[model samples]
Target: MRQDTEVRTFRDGPSPATRRRVLAGGALAAGLGGVGAAASEARTAEVGGVRHGTVRADGVDVFYREAGRPDAPVFLLLHGFANSSFYFRHLMPRLADRFRLIAPDLPSFGFTVVPDDRGYVYDFASLSRTVGAFVDALGLRRYLLYTFDYGAPVGWDLALAHPERIAGIVSQNGNAYLEGLGEAAWAPLRAYWAKPNAAAVESIRARMTLDGVKAPYFHGVPDPSVIEPESYTLDAAILARPGNADRQVTLKLDYKRNLERYPLIQAYFRERRPKLLAVWGRNDLFFIPPGAEAFRRDIPDARVRFLDTGHFALETNGDDIAREIRDFF
Candidate 1:
């Protein structure tokens, strides 16, 4: 059993090297429109000492970013809505020296290519299965999980399915409690959920635009100027793909399924008692701070820390988050 440790707060700005790599990656992605040639360049660039590649998993070309020594303890990073492994560009390099970090872009979100003939369903279960296959393809028997936004449910599904494989979990705004659902932030989604009609679809569809993609990054952030345009720009470009918007809509609806399984996830936390570190952005418009606090309900020892940022916490607080992970683990 891991020994208990006091939580230490870190407030340093991202290192110059980390900033340069992030800007370089954003520039490359923005220049290449965030996919196809851009992804190709990322595969070979080794930006920020991180390597990008793809592996065949569940019949999809899963694009992922990897760093750190191969023999070190693995940290599988699962991203959330409208973002990809690109979101981890800063956090990866910071911890690469100490732990093996792998961040994969899920289907419909990042550079992962899903063939038209595969007839993929953009739901949580299907998404989880693909990630599971990706894990199998990599032969990862045990590893820690770093889940954010949509990643929370996906990681929870993996843990529930194979409790033995998960060494611990680092949930960064990855919600698993009912109270975590911020009513106002999720109003649009809730309206759609209540009535899956054309109007409801249109309401959620508004979020697919470039401005919509940028909203979360600025919300709850202390200094909006610090947030980079490349991050949301890349997300917007990929989301503008021919069929990706509709797939995103399908995913929004399927999120209800994740909420339904909250009890089961909490039960896992109670029974398995996996080491949990909930580092949250208190001002997040979507998943609120209570969600982080709720983790302690099931696992009393679960560490819950809140940052002064919003939904995309890493955009403004990458250094602090990386430090917390290092100290906690």
Candidate 2:
């Protein structure tokens, strides 16, 4: 999961077509702003307790974990690449008393199911579209976005599409800066983007095994035993599903699209300057700590802290993260 955290700027400037699309999207976003704000005002009561359920949205059965008061300020948790909403199991209960937590399994991951019609693109853009629909289906008008790993792109995409809906952002090793892409770890991905052949596919899928599932969770923890076994066990089971490995490979190949959008994502931060809090695992090989510090460039007041953990910081610092989130939100 390691990446080269060197700043890279692709595409000198937006093409004429890109400019037109951005203008059109801006108009649409302005029109939709009031819709979410009004909805938030209506659902102001706190929810009762933690629960699990599924909602049919965007042609997928989206599974999610919910806790805290229905009327409490909402916190939308977006998990990383190898894990689902389950990754937030420990952190969710910790803050349930103060916040309304909604953590969903993105399409092609976790318990969420998508039909086999090949209609779903499984790329970041398509996943982002599905998440937007998922949020609408759940009637979540506004919330703080907690994004990690893969969730970073998805959450940012949603924010850009519906800026009015984002109350703030909490980035935990969720990289948006190009300098955060460390080359050594990103070799396989870079190879895939360049060649995209069977060998490249194999390189991307190499980590789909059990060892790979366990690697990130324990990467930098002083006492690996502190990380629950169930975390990797559940993720490995999901990865072993029929066609799941291939689906993941497809997503990995599509990661380049996210890199392409990095500039635009940064632009959103510079322009909108949403309230940002970044809690990073300093020892993380993937999305290294520098990525967290980079947030301040776009958001002067962004609060960034480094935890002594790995990619899955929650595995080692769940209590601290929960506390930080509670105080901040």
Worst lDDT 10-window in candidate 1: 1-10
lDDT string, candidate 2, 123-230, tens digits: 888888778877776666678899999999999999989888788899999999888876777988888677767886776688899998888888888889898999
Best by TM-score: 1
User: C-alpha displacement of 201 in model 2, angstroms?
Assistant: 2.1
Per-residue accuracy of model 1 over 85-133 as CA lDDT, tens digit each: 9999999999976666779889888888887877788899989988887
Q: Report how far residue 234 has shifted in candidate 2, in Å.
A: 0.6
Off by over 4 Å in 2: 1-48
Q: Global CA lDDT of candidate 1, please?
A: 0.81
How close to the true structure is residue 201 of candidate 1, measured as C-alpha lDDT?
A: 78
Residue runs of model 1 more than 4 Å from their true location after superposition: 1-48
Best by lDDT: 1
